[model samples]
Target chain A: MMPMKLEDLLRTKPVFVNVGVRSFGDSLREAGYQVIHVDWSPPAGGDQKMAELLDDLL
Target chain B: MTLKEKINAANEEALRRIVAANPVLVDVAPASEVVPGMRDKLILHSGPPVTWERMCGAQRGAAIGMCLFEGWAKDAASAERMLAQGEIAFEPNHHHATVGPMAGTITKNMWVWVVQNKAFGNRAQCRQVESFQQFGDYSKEALSGLQKWRDIWAPTLRAAVRKMDGVMLKPLIARALQMGDEMHNRVVASSSIFANAIAPILVDCGRSKEDVVATLYYIGNHPFLFLGLAMAAGKAAMDPARGIEASTVVTAMARNGTEFGIQVSGLDGEWFTAPSPRVKGLFLPGWKDADAGADMGDSAITETVGWGGAVIGGAPGILTFTGGTAEEALGFSREMRNISVGRSPDYLIPALNFEGAAVGIDIRKVMQTNTVPVIDTAIAHKEPGHSIIGGGIVRPPLECFKKALTRFGEKYKE
Candidate 1:
């Protein structure tokens, strides 16, 4: 299967999560890609997944 | 064997290889005259310095461009072929007691920054900086821009250099170091001083305003406008100290596209090397991870000889690209202080409360700490073709240091 292009990935997923600096995400959205930034440490990976409990959104 | 001994051997071997390669300085001409096998080669770049494996991206591209410029090859493909064929030589600037800016390339015919150690018969060379090749970007704009620099900017600079009684930029740089300007990212003070020194000569030379303006603008714009000067100064300092039997001080560090190399005081002019490490830093806005090239060039010799990234705290602005805060920069300076043989009374740092910049990196410290030297450098993605997209920090592999240390021990086994 072909990998999804960033544009395709973004069109389906209106929001995105960037773990590091928000600067990359901000620039991405400016290029018409919607992204949501999440600032979390390595230990918080589990909590982050739980926080993204968007069964309805999915 | 003691780690120091091993390091000395490595340094010796590295030096022997470089000297045996018989890399002679080419023409007394300027950068525009860069043909090939010139007596002087200028290196331009940032970081801990690199060898060939580390040479990548814009630097590699530029190396190819340099081959084209020198007529060594019809294009990059032929250049690579020549490099592989071993028909053409691959010598680092450090081997010649020189430094290069980003994607540093010194072909024959190009005028080089010629700084002979009047005290020791030793000499160093470096290439001129591009007029506007900041970010090491290899866009259409960047290539054309460099061409303009070669044709128009370089000749004018040559004329200006000729007019001036051979500008010795070290004193100016040393003074600037004392005055709030770090020799790396924050060279406002250095640039101003250089401009002041050269401006008078330029004005009196009776050149056209556009040429003069262009030259002045180029000099004033790059914070590292003093890179050539610093390489020359470092060469002066280290050349005098070379061939000290028990001394494990590094004399030079440089990279081509295939290896990272180092030369030590004890080793004289040998080049000990290991695979170069990939640089860690911010990438360009649009480029993907695959679009970058590996590390390339001889510019890092500046840091290996001291200055560039070694004294980062002296230049806080470097934090943005080198992947650190101002505090980290300061810490880097302090850390380097622990390893050096002495502080440079000449290159004083204002931020460290008038402390002298770290002068020499001791081989013992590298072996004990396993902390290979860290350098702030621009990042080129692993892919080829694209120019420099972003920059950050990187550390030379400890293996190189270990190898140097190990070799030093055997060579001087008493």
Candidate 2:
């Protein structure tokens, strides 16, 4: 139910990185992108996306 | 000698020599402005506890001098009168973002190191470790020693600092970490590196040869000066991560006059505290357990940030005094890596083949492992009477982490 619009229509052939909530069922499914999901815990303070971005930036 | 050999060999001897090197009073300020979490009317001490009765005579006498220095009271009698009147401020050095070695006193005019970490946009501060008043050994001898330090010693050194354009210790510390010098009880590599770095600066600063030589000898002799620099650097690195929602990074670990409090990253500046724990370790010769004090001060953050005792094997010499085995020291270094996020490429442990010391405290790893951080610290007595007796080990209360995780969960949950 977590806006699976991207998950449902996505092609099954290519693996996609799934940056989704752990609460979402599709989180368990395979995709092109490696799945990185946050647990029931809330997002931590600071830039949550900073790590992924640093990867992109650096 | 190779820089490494020179540093390691001179490390302790340097600490011994710093006592006589004559540290001039560079500057002084109130604890609140110079250090964080300080309030008026409270006095701060260093290391672990020593009761008023058992405190080294020298430290007690220094406290009397501090009282006079602060003008809190006219003399020891007036100071005692004010303290007995409950009008004096007594606190631990840890509560503020500063560290003191023994009977650590922060007055309005003491020169402190101000370290700014450009990478993190934070600052950390510390007082000089050159002198020893916390020993409770203050007497006519001790008071004269303090006077000489303030008038004669502190100035020659302050001039040196002026000549050198201030010290940039981060690079040397980074190199030491890689070279097997943990910045805590063992500072051989760091001290040597510091001397090497400063020597060039001293030469270029255009100071008199004698002054430069005096400063050089002083630095060459006392290995612990870098401890303040390392603490300041660690403070700068860690302060930025404070107040991040759901981040479990610890900001400050300090002992107030009465309790040990830790501020976690996710909690955003809330202090979770517990009664101060006692330091466990060997004491100086002739020192007995009854004479030891409870844990005190904010310097342990160096370990929390991964230096101090966390990398003890890098300083095997300290093991003799701190009551640790080399194997255990090595184990501590490796175990710390497990909970940390990265290694400081600058600070390398030589025995580990120039492996970087652990850096960054990861909250997730701490939550999963339940390994509360360990810190090697000095102990002071609980009551206001004594200054510092000896040094030992302590653990940050686990509740601080538990509470941080609980809050981080709530803040980030969908």
Candidate 3:
């Protein structure tokens, strides 16, 4: 049997949470959907050393 | 103890100090008299420390204007030579426990508002906001405008504040938040409240009648006057939270035209800096983003403590100035909510269903969520010698936050 929740999700509109590029959220909203922009960037802006340090933290 | 536990406990302590803070309008005095280590020949600019050669346009202009105001030089050319020759000393406002907006140029003789955190027993000072000088214009008219502030406006304000014997700021800022003041870019409510509350007291401040009238008019007409107080209050409140070991809570954020910088509670005096970002929003007529400078000001101190863009959801009134619909402004606040540790109980946001204003930005959350603090500030011209070109929104570079978090990890090695 297929997952019941997937069918429910498709039937009702899903809220999109766009992780970066805020304009994606704006575009989604303009296309008649609810969207939340995360205003994200690469972990540590793609700095290998800094990303390693961040990964080491709590 | 686990690293997570250490961060959690330390951040709790920082927020304790922040919420317990009671900043009062304590006094008004010249920078030399009150600013720690302020000297006759010294001028202070905003953000982390930056030197003359790297100085942005507005800041260079403001510094030259200050030199002229101090009578260190009779002409702009002379002042430029003296400043360049190291004949005069300048420093960042943050280094001296003070803050300012825009170019943030303040000098030895300029009068400063002193906000004392009554609970923390520390004081923070900032000078009032005037139009031309902060944007780096040093025309004779602009210089003369500052002269009038030194000669007339400052003295009247000083007398009135002294007579009031310490107006309480927590209530005013809290109330103004309710009245739709963003407490950074648009401070009409707080400025108006301050002027109205002081008008009657100025009657007893003992200046000549004509002087009092002119001073009241100045205060009433200027909407940005209270932006300086919010900066000083933020400084006063956040100072006691400094050096809370293991805390990832940001204690300060600021920008010079060249860079944006921040200090973490655990890091003490060290600043994590990144290149300043351009503002994205409405511009005054005949100007666009090209004419805008890199974001600059010491005013992000307000947002660090949870006001301005941190709670813009409740301040739709500023949307008229910064250009956005109310729901979009609320969306920005919801995004800010993702990075903050929690909401402040004392400062409430009605539009968010009377939720307390989001407070205590946590670096861990910022990194985990990949969100930086949202800033609402005015755009100064990239080159000096111009007035404000526009108002808009901005953010500190993510690189600054990443660098800060990396350093925090190094310092807290298990």
Candidate 4:
């Protein structure tokens, strides 16, 4: 896939991919900024060594 | 510019200074040896200044234990008498450029992690982790554990630190955030990383093999060993941001069992406090929520510099410990941004697509949003003499932020 250009990304409504703290997104919206909330979960059920191993595998 | 605008500009400048801070671990030494004004008779406790008369159960227990540890009293009864008679001077750890976890008691003889904000050339110290005493346990087991740390662990670690000249903590912290540590409730990654960094130094310090082995084993097994170092680092990073006039940024957030307190940059040493909020989440197998102590510790220093509970979304593993779902973690992380002025440049949350963790909590934003800062903390027992009962999430009382806002207006508006 072709990489998205920075200018193109900017030209579109800036979607802030907020990963933690939901209030951040609320604040952004209150400020009229577009925010995309990503539901982040621990990879491999929160095991760091397992996550690292999977990262290597994937 | 309008008065509001001027305040905003000053706050922005203060937050910039905070995010720009570079904290490095310089050495390990006894509290009296490194912490300024940490005299032989002075005892530093966490949260805002509270007298021995007002200290809650765990704090009182910890103080008595410290007196016993220092050989100032022959027994707990004697220690209690000394504390009541004002034989030991009590002060907040903040007054001495130090921070402590949980019951947060620091005596002169205890070893401390010395962290320096290289950018500001300011230093902060924190006591080494002890399972019992810091949590208000003064049992024979607890006292022996403290003795082991003093006699064996601290000296070995100090020698290793000296051999290495100093360990740069920021890089390790940065990496640990990526590996799944928020540097607060979930510090497994940072602890392992720190142990690895210092292992070679320990080997090269020319200590007896047995002592080195025991110290290495202790550090390797103790999951929360790096928590104190992180707290000291956080204190160092936040210290430079304090005392900025008209700046509404929060410089500190700490809780004793009875009260939660916060200091705003503009207000300097003044603390706005309220009743300590109860933690809402999981408890240990035998414990119930009713037994939990109110939020306690100076560990919120991590959130001040934009790690720990601030980056919960990046550390999904924390959910297992804090009894929250992945989505809740994400929400918690996003929520902090509402009250913060900016994101950290160094401490990025990998799960958030490498976005910087929210940094520089602004009291104005907290008040405006009616949002109290969220903290992930371990719950202690309400009464003294019990170790940690469980881990959970907590928020500083809204009254604290409201009072801070009131104080800010009073200080800067006129």
When sorted by lDDT, best at the front, the candidate numbers are 3, 4, 1, 2
Q: Can you give the lDDT of residue B307 in candidate 1? A: 76
Compare candidates 2 and 4 on lDDT and give the better one.
4
Question: B307 in model 4: Cα distance from truth in Å?
Answer: 1.4
Q: How would you encode candidate 1's per-residue C-alpha lDDT over B135-180 as one tens digit per residue? A: 3443456556555556665566666667764665556766776665
Q: Provide the overall lDDT of each model, using Cα atoms, as 2-decimal numbers.
A: 0.58, 0.56, 0.87, 0.84
lDDT tens digits, residues B241-326, model 2? 55554444555666532346676655664666665666678776656677664555567767766678667767777766568788
What TM-score would chain B of candidate 3 score versus the native chain B? 0.98
| Candidate 1 lDDT (Cα, 0 to 1) | 0.58
In every candidate, how many clashes are there? 75, 79, 0, 11
Q: Which window of 10 residues has the lowest lDDT sum in candidate 3 chain B?
A: B362-371
Judging by lDDT against the true structure, name the best candidate. Answer: 3
Candidate 2 vs 4: which has more TM-score: 4
Point out where model 1 deviates above 4 Å. A1-58, B1-28, B31-60, B71-89, B118-121, B131-143, B288-291
Q: What range of 10 consecutive residues in model 1 chain B has the weakest lDDT sum?
A: B18-27
DockQ, candidate no. 2? 0.02
Error of 1 at B72 (Å): 5.3
Better-scoring candidate (lDDT), 3 or 4? 3
Question: What TM-score does each of the candidates earn?
Answer: 0.71, 0.68, 0.93, 0.87
